[model samples]
Target: MNSKEFLNELKKYSNDLLVSMSFDQIFKEELLKLYPRKIINCHAGKLPFYRDRNILNWALINNEKEFGISVHFIDKGINTGDIILQKTYEIKDSDDYTTLLNLCHKECASLLYESLILFLEDNVKAYKQKRKKKGGGNI
Candidate 1:
């Protein structure tokens, strides 16, 4: 849980690194000397909206019609990253929080895997998602 252990473990992964710190708590001193590269995060909500936690819950509560996943570049602002790729799915009225979340999680994992493959192949830059611009998702 501490910084030293966290950084050490992160260094073990190839092409993947983990930093155990709140976005606000991560300081430049901890990473300034390290390699400067694009850092991306997959989010459950669409960008410029639904920017915080419990995305699926929010979608269900708001009665959205569709929900999707977004892979984007991390920026100083939350959920404001430049989108790389997005995949969406229809939300059924019978879908609850758990169902919606499970679906979104599956899509997120797939997107990340596909994006990594694309990056390795030098075939793409990033993905951008476009959500349904209508009513909220099913409750």
Candidate 2:
């Protein structure tokens, strides 16, 4: 019913790390405080850029030539967490939302895996995400 109660329940589980991709829900202060940098997320879109959902379509509708993926520490803000890794994939004229989404599926998995390794090894170096620029993600 509260932070302490929730934490006690969590302690019953042996999960040492929390990383997400399909989890679009926002984590408030209490949960965030539990993990700090240990709470990570592989965002489907570029942080502070194409936030929320429908990112692939946003990129396509905006006539973007590239699609981006970011793995970051999940902060209280909406996808405004510190970035662990960010990489973009080219979007050719023939590509559509479905294609971009598929690309993100692969890229997100790869990036998340790489990030987790770095985290477990204590080799991670996170950087604050900059403010949002124009739509369609910053290049």
Models, CA RMSD each: 5.4, 2.9
Give the per-residue lDDT digits (tens) of candidate 2, residues 60-86: 888887867999888887788889999
Runs off by more than 4 Å, candidate 1: 1-35, 127-139
Q: Which is the leading candidate under lDDT? A: 2
Q: In candidate 2, residue 47 scores what lDDT?
A: 73
- lDDT against true structure, model 2: 0.81
The residue-level lDDT of candidate 2 at 80 comes to 84
Q: What is the C-alpha lDDT of each candidate?
A: 0.63, 0.81
Model 2 CA deviation exceeding 4 Å by range? 1-7, 133-139
Q: What is candidate 1's local distance difference test score?
A: 0.63
TM-score of candidate 2 versus the correct structure, residues matched by position: 0.87
Model 1, poorest ten-residue lDDT window?
A: 17-26
Best candidate (score: TM-score): 2
- TM-score to true structure, per model: 0.70, 0.87
lDDT of 1 by residue, 54-124 (tens): 77888887788987677776655555556777777899989999888777767887887876776678765
Give me candidate 1's TM-score against the actual structure. Answer: 0.70
